[model samples]
Target: MTSAAGATALVLALNKPVYPLYVWFLAESAFHLSLLTALTMPLYLAVWHLSRSGKGRAARLGMVIVGIVDTLAIALILGGESETLAFLFACLMLAGLSFYRSEVWLSRGLVAAIFVLFVALEGRIGAPLMPVEEDDMRSLAFLNVTGAAALAAFIMLRFPRAERPD
Candidate 1:
């Protein structure tokens, strides 16, 4: 892709973090997950292309967009009085996307911050932290997202990036 195309793609990654918000938190219907994931197809494809030979601009922008989107989505959800498990779940996936696109400490840090904020907001607000008695799947899904984020951070730390020159 050309530099401009790559740059735009990178910018679009900003929306990647919005996925898990619906997937993990707010989605009550199967349609929600399928629908939101479908919406994110372009975001992931752009990431894939950037991670290839699309150059530094695209890759960096993609990583940044991924981080910012999750943060923004959470803030919006939290402030709007709609902080559901589905939204948090979507944010978690967005963190994982950040983990994949850029091997940066900030990427991992953003996820960690979001996690803390998520837990704090929910607990402080009396939102359900644990699943209902029979909702083991939801519980497992939360743990899985947590595990994936840690793994992603470990990988990123182990493989530091070379600083690009301006």
Candidate 2:
């Protein structure tokens, strides 16, 4: 997920001409996007280290928090038109898949938080921090849609499947 986010941002930054609206006034919009995505790597690494240390619950909680906050921040930075909200759905999927059935409360709480955040911010948000051309928002939207889909698919594939009862 982290890698995908960074890669998408990089692609956007490198192909400025392809997204004129995105880079019209703020030629650095894509660059800033890449930077923000890169900044989340260390937090993801810390979560990985915690999981490796056998702190399963803490790691799961950390993942949920980091994923939610990161997605929300990106959505806010890009504004509603970029369709970055797609990543919030990815975050919800992560929370749902991160916990065992026994940890229902944690999963429910995290999912609810994501749901509330999505509802509150979806269309209610204002323009992006760095405004882009109206037509160019489609480019960002495409990147976000594919990025979110890839993240969701990767998460589903990587998570362990439940054992069947005899």
Highest lDDT, which number?
2
Candidate 2 lDDT trough over 10 residues, lowest sum: 3-12
All candidates: TM-score: 0.37, 0.78
Write model 2 residue lDDT over 27-138, tens digit each, in one string: 4445454345445656666766666667777776777787777677767777878787888887798778778888899889989989998898888877878657656677
**Tens digits of per-residue lDDT for model 1, 1-166:** 1333333344344434544554455333322322333344465456557767746545544544543454344333332223333344444544444343445565577567667766766534432232222243354345435534553454344334556999
lDDT of 2 at 65: 80
Off by over 4 Å in 2: 1-29
lDDT (CA) for every model shown? Answer: 0.44, 0.66
Q: For each of the candidates, give the backbone clash count.
A: 17, 0
The candidate that wins on TM-score is: 2
Residue 12 lDDT, candidate 1, scale 0-100: 41
